[model samples]
Target: MAKIAFILLCHKDPEGIIRQAERLTAVGDCMSIHFDASAPKSEYDRIRKALDGNPNVTFARRRVRCGWGEWSLVQATLHAVEAAVSAFPGATHFYMLSGDCMAIKSAEYAHDFLDSADIDYIESFDFFGSDWIKTGIKEERLIYRHLFNERSNKRLFYGAMELQKRLGWRRKIPADLQVMIGSQWWCLRRRTIEWVLDFTRKRKDVMRFFRTTWIPDETFFQTIVRHVVPDAEIRSRTLTFLMFSDYGMPVTFYNDHYDLLLAQDFLFARKVSPEARELKRRLGVLYASEGTEFRISNEGQRLYRFVTDRGREGRRYAPRFWEAEASLGRERELLIVICKKWHVARRLAGIVRQELDLPVIEYLFDEGKTELPDLGGIQSTIEKRTRHRRALMRMLFDYHKTDRLLVCMDPRNFELLQDFCADRATTRLLEIQCRFCDDYLTGHAKRIGLAGEQAGPEAMARLLPTIRNDLRHESDRIADAGFAHLNRMRETAGPDENAVPLAAFLSIPEDKARAIAAMENLFSD
Candidate 1:
């Protein structure tokens, strides 16, 4: 088995951090930790004392004062990764995580999964309307230069930013670099982390550019992964479960969310607050228990049902006819299945939901009165003004303020999403969809001459004699004219047609815009 090193970036909750470290030690996992530099030295001493003299645990000397969405988050993360690499230089794998995150599975199961995975577990996709941020917010994040951190006076900063955007300061990201952003947490090999650090160090321009970009943590590392390790063994998914509130804050999980947490095939979950007494008690019980299998107690099920019943009362979407004191919160990340027909979009959405481990918000533009899909027995589709384009704009731009991954399932909704790509350039879009990994692995087993009549998780686990991997590399399609710039970029095309020009977003005349798009071959394939 490959030795694993865990790197954690934490801000608050020293007790939680120590407990997690203890759990890792119990499971024979080594850890390297970095506390937020802003945390007082006394706090650091306390933390060090808790884990003192544990041969397996090491601490990063260079602590970083992290502010969310700032360059410092990336700085802190890099520091932790560097410390881990230094301490466990020979470790085969490094699992990067946040302090709030806790493993749901036993250490053995977690290690087994990592051993089974032949690729780095990091999700990266094209940025600029490509799944970086929620629709309305993407333009602000990817296009406009973010000069101020969260600590700066917000009102003055945003007002100045808007003025700057009007004055042509909001430039499109550079063409030489393709911005790929995804979940910040990832599990990668030593070589991968080394390459990322080395690549960024050499490319100070990319590093500095990211410093001025909003939420560099979400973009910096991911962009490096695409540019430096584009062809490296990598799968586009984080094996951790983190539920975010409508406004993108991590939701503090309680006993109700316990069942939901266990249901997903994730190794870790985040923000399990110590304040929630019942939740803390349940988690303690969970930690005390052993084995790889995740089973909910009868009491857990009852609590879950009670929570869901109350939760169902708060609808996730509101197109019409539902009074509420407040609107229902949406999933932090939504997998938008974009296709022409309702049926095609519907079918693809189900598969995507199961495979991607995210909620399906079907965004269909050209349904032409076809009945919205029932998704019967596979996975229920949440009808969020889905079959119409205007409704989609409203939901994405108006009400729900959550990040979205738009998937162009077929060529039909391609044009509509293309227009969106022109406007919200950072909304992540996926052209290729994989079936549920578990299901895919099973069928894959038969093709690989494995003796698995029934390809279940366990059956495939037994067949894990060698991780016969067949995940894709550079295998997504560019069908939209709005995304032609990305194609030119991947081709390493010279000067022209390389990136979305800043002028494209500035209100140029229609004919001039057409000429620019034509010049970039945006309208063409």
Candidate 2:
């Protein structure tokens, strides 16, 4: 068996890590884990106990603190790599695994690809003169420019930009120099690993520059690798079986797309939720038997076999929904309404109930399952409220019974709601724009003349009527245009009288010359 070291960096999800290790043990020669220093001691102890008696598993002594857009994660990764290299010196490749990652292909196929590729499989991109540099500037003038004009994070944008300039860093890469951006999660050959570690150790200035930088994990490895070997035959994309968000974060895979997942040509996927256990079991069985094929029968449809690893296949039956009995006297339809603020969601629930004459199932994660509070005294915080909104949006998309979805919030919040709805396969959406009554607007003079100050209530009131009218007009136009397009597509074009010979009529539209074509020419082999 080929030697491959698996290094997993974990924080909270120890169980997830154990499951991944068990799966990869069939392929990987050795596994190493580095726990986050900040994790609870009890949690760490539990993780240690879970790994007990596994001959291939080893735990790192030095723990590293990890946070969003921080350098600690890179430090932790390097530590794990060094340990793995020392323990398994003969290992040809180092495969970095996250607790969330899962294998999608057979071990033999994965090993074959790794051996054949020779080049490192890391997600990389070119970052020369990109907006990423502007994230470091902190000046008020530059910060305001980025916020109002560029539409970026006001504080971080200015901070990162300013820091880069002050450090006497090369603002631009030389014309001869090549730069590449890549994700930290990847598989690297032994030679590439040695080169990466040596270059980082030698470049003290670069190390110092990254120590306090935002999103160092994204930039550090990328900057170093590009500096050393710009032309290295590297696969600057993940070879793994799963697609991730732009930031390399795993996305939730649901049971509905089980067939689609099987069809994809990938070795592994990540972040499988506990809900997908049955799908995982079925996949395991399909891959276990080589040259065997499985067919799925759905509703009276012909059985079709889905191909699996090593040219094997398995049959997938139509999901037996009837096998799982529903509770007696269950609600036929349940519509869940979510808002970050308990009072806002409660108020929206009331409006939905009153307007649509349907009692909504209200969910507020921050607040327990209790009666809705009075709307008058409700205090709302942006962060907490947005979480509830997202949770509600996700629930609405997943639940089939949520036929009608209503969102009662500000314009910005409503936009997010619409985006969430579009992500899901659903057409039911309603928006209720919230506005403050004139009686509530007291002693606050909105400054219209000032550049930075907000516009006045009178100005807002004047704009509301026009906005509403435009919205109604736009909605009608869209509906009419859709119908017109559908009708045009359905209509058949008649043959033209002035038709040329088949060979000479290449320029003529086929729909226009349908009748006059010679029968032999039309049916030619």
How do the residues 1-525 of candidate 2 rate in per-residue lDDT, one tens digit apiece? Answer: 356788888887666667656556644467878889888878888778977677677777578876665567788888888877777777788777776555555566566668776677776666654443444342222112121212335476556555756775433222443344556667777887888888777766566556655565766676666556545677776655554443435566666545544434455556566667766665555434344322211111001111111123111111123312221112222232322223444553564356445435444323343333333222144333343444433344344244444333322233333333333323222222222333222211122111112333443444345344433443343334332111110011222322232112222354433333312222111
Cα-based RMSD of the predictions, in order? Answer: 21.3, 24.5
lDDT of each: 0.58, 0.49
List model 1 lDDT by residue over 168-211, tens digit each: 88675766888888998888877888898898779887776787
In order of appearance, the predictions have TM-scores of 0.57, 0.50
Ten contiguous residues with the weakest lDDT in model 1: 320-329
